[model samples]
Target: MELQIGKYTARISVLPPIHPKFRITPEPAAPNSTDGEEEQIEAEPISGFTCIIGYTSGGGEVSERLITCRSLRAHGTGLTIGAICHAAKGFRAFRVDRISAVSDPHTGEVIGDGSYFSRFAVKSSDKARAPSGGWGLTPSRMRTLVAGLNVLSFIARCDGYWHALEDEPLANFIERLWMRKDWEGQPPVAAILDHAKRLAPDSSIFFASLETIFGSRSSTRLLISSVRELIEADGIIQDQETNWVLAMQQHQEEYYARKGLLGSI
Candidate 1:
């Protein structure tokens, strides 16, 4: 068959499934309104491997099986090595007519397989850093980084600063934090601070401190609300000061228990 690509008309050919004697041609061009430019296409031919070409079924009608850049763990080619369109089944299908060019890397042989779908190596460059949930930096370091973030830096990252950390007072406080030295090389600090300021431009030191530990003032408010609810439900007699005293006593008891020291609850 002959098909036209751009301004150039090239011959296209396919081998018979029975006694395959393939004689390929450049696909001829058809009239197009876009622009006039000759399309360059070529294919590579491998010596030992079997190669064949044919038409592709137009889109969705074909099977989902594709020779993706994945594993070769499958035994033999479920669908022969080189096939076209729906026939590509599990075969490595390369577009012969659309191929720009082909060249053998090892021998530098200018083969005719570039247009044909051939297998190649694939690689990834993404780094898998440690996961960041469940726990965070120690309280002191967290505070230091939060204090070191600001609005300009936040705006630079161009993420939703306002929605992530909603507190005007806290935002303002974090903007001032950008001057601290401990946040060097810390992109998260800048991103979080920028997000906070965008959310709450007028935020303050106290709210900033709260946000550093609990994420946002709203979260801290929710925590305080839950604690108040617990206090009301339990009918606690102790105030904040007394609660602190009791908490300290509980810590002392835990410390003693860890050291083989026993006491009542």
Candidate 2:
């Protein structure tokens, strides 16, 4: 994660944890359990932190709510969180690997309401389909694990922007970032283009994924900078976009100060 602090930058990396417990292999639910009874959990998540969590439904479906991270227990290769979903009515469990983002209920943005999401206007595109997987885990969780473990990190800041180009600048930026790090190793440019094409158009999902992989603060900087590039892709920065970036910049300052990362800056 890189934070543009005044004329300098604050760089930090939160490495992915290695564990095979990211899957969910549960026994078939008893037909009678829907009568207000709950499934037997392996264990419960430790209680007390109240926040919001984004959970992956059967497939590519996404749902968010203010939830209390209650108890945590090993599921498969990862863990399951016992939480109370606030959007609906009651206590429930969420796959740890599938959690999109967690944030302070009162003060923090729901991970995407900040500068990171101010770019890309919603396209009203048809919902993307997620591969089927049930009684186990959703396909999104596995992809999350893969991407987290092997991050094709992008490193770039405001360079040359506000220039007109009919070509795919964002796609080009993605390819160059990966190649510069040699992380994904020289895939044909076409492959990178395809990857970008397949990327989730929902900015919230992407931001949540980042928070799930990295920590909240780390994801904040990364999300903001990347979105900044996307916003400037048209070679013309709009008033709304510029204001959102400024708001995010201020958000980062208050955040770091709260965490003391800005004390000596």
Listed in order, each prediction's TM-score against the native is 0.16, 0.31
Alpha-carbon local distance difference test for all models: 0.28, 0.37
Best by lDDT: 2
Residue 41 lDDT in candidate 2: 18
Name the regions of candidate 2 deviating beyond 4 angstroms: 1-167, 179-184, 192-195, 198-229, 262-265
Candidate 2 TM-score versus the reference: 0.31
Least lDDT summed over 10 consecutive residues: which range in candidate 2?
114-123
What does the lDDT read for residue 71 in candidate 2?
44
Candidate 1 regions with alpha-carbon error over 4 angstroms: 1-137, 147-180, 198-265
Cα lDDT tens digits for candidate 1, 1-265: 1222222112111111222233233333334421211121111111112222333433623122211111111124322223222232222334333333333322333345433333221112312332222013332433333322322222211222122223333433333333332333433444453222322111122222223324333333333333233233324323432342243234435445665655422
Candidate 2 local lDDT, 72-100, one digit each (tens): 54566656656445454345666766776
Candidate 2: residue 177 Cα off by (Å): 2.5
Native-referenced Cα lDDT, model 1: 0.28
